[model samples]
Target: TAAPGPQLFLSLCLSRLKFPSDLDELRELAETLKFYKQEHYGYVLLLYCSAYLYKQSFAIPGSSLLNMLAGAIFGPWEGLFLACLLTTSGSTFCFLLSRAFGKQYVVHFFPEKVALLQRKAEENRSSLFFFLLFLRFFPMTPNWFLNITCPVLNIPMPIFFSSVFIGLIPYNFICVRTGSILSEISSLDDIFSWGTLAQLLAIALVALLPGALIKRYGHAHLKVDGLDGDGRDQAGRHRKRR
Candidate 1:
């Protein structure tokens, strides 16, 4: 008998690469998994979770497909829960790894940005939670970059974890639910329609508002204090009305 591990791993990678686009093929794959679901549901879940974690830890690019599979296989609520769990755990692992060993590489690749971002993160440590929420919710912000940068920026662990856990819920909800209706999707673009984009952008904007307002207010207050100082100080006021 031939050892089947390599073949199985290759097939898994190929299937992931061919995801949603090859609906018919995915349907067949799903049916095969369904047989396993019948015989050993626990095994299926373990494989799925491990694969998700592996992809995240390695910076692989097929998580969106896995998100959909979560819904299609486990149903919306279960899929949503699993996706959130895997995303948080996997992202945290990546963050810690980057913190441990990614500084020199990031500095080499993005010399200017690394120092500037580190300074800004240190200056606005108190507001990192909102900034993180905005980044996580905003579609344009890449999760992999955030994962690498969060630790590099020295963002607190609690804020980073909480932002990911909470900020990702809305988008995860959309993705996991989309999985349930994968049969109707003709292309991956359908996963994120304009309306959906608007919703995510709106959430990101809301998350960003407090930080923006605070920054604006601080600047304005500084300007006002500077203008006041130009006129007179407490001792000057006591000396004369001029």
Candidate 2:
């Protein structure tokens, strides 16, 4: 029999691969993929990027595993850069896909969430970018939810891309760095411990501060809808007699 071509070799490799569901499985998967990467560097890179983008662009979960795989194959700095770049690119693709085709479905399925986000967006319109950064930095926030609903919230594309790219640096760094020391990890909790959560929460709060200040102090000088001469919202004031 002739030697298998790169495609056939890749197919055989993928057939043995499964998405890791736990620490041991993740370690095994990492080792297997690392060997393949050594043997077929270009094909492995393409495969990894495609998988990452597919999950992100379609809002599928399980990015943590991919980040670790990147670190195992490419080392810390390279993996971090690749993870960050792919994340931004994939998220922007999601944003565009949602804008073009998923809007109606998103609105119909999550009407209340859409309405809530719209109100929040209006409330933070002055410091919208900071508000977005806050959302991205907040660990409890569901990024997939934001990705799908952002278009309906009328968030500008530039702001969306920049926030996703810059605001997620810490998060991506944590994952990729953890991947560098994967052999030492015993559980998922090791990747995001209480201390890590606290740090992320602190960053989120700091990101929110600028938006809070703008909402408090900048409203008076800006032209705001449904606000009166005193800068109090019109809804709070009693109507004048005709």
Best model per TM-score: 2
For model 1, residues 141-233, the per-residue Cα lDDT tens digits are: 357656777777878888888888887776667667666566334587965878546645654665466546644654543221221222223
Residue 66, model 1: lDDT of: 78
Candidate 2 lDDT over residue span 14-36, tens digit each: 68766666767877877766766
**Residue 125 shift from truth in candidate 2, angstroms:** 1.1
Give TM-scores for every candidate, taking all chains together and pairing residue i with residue i.
0.66, 0.73
Q: Pick the candidate with the highest lDDT.
A: 2
What are the Cα lDDT values of the candidates? 0.65, 0.72
Q: Report lDDT (Cα) of residue 79, candidate 2.
A: 92
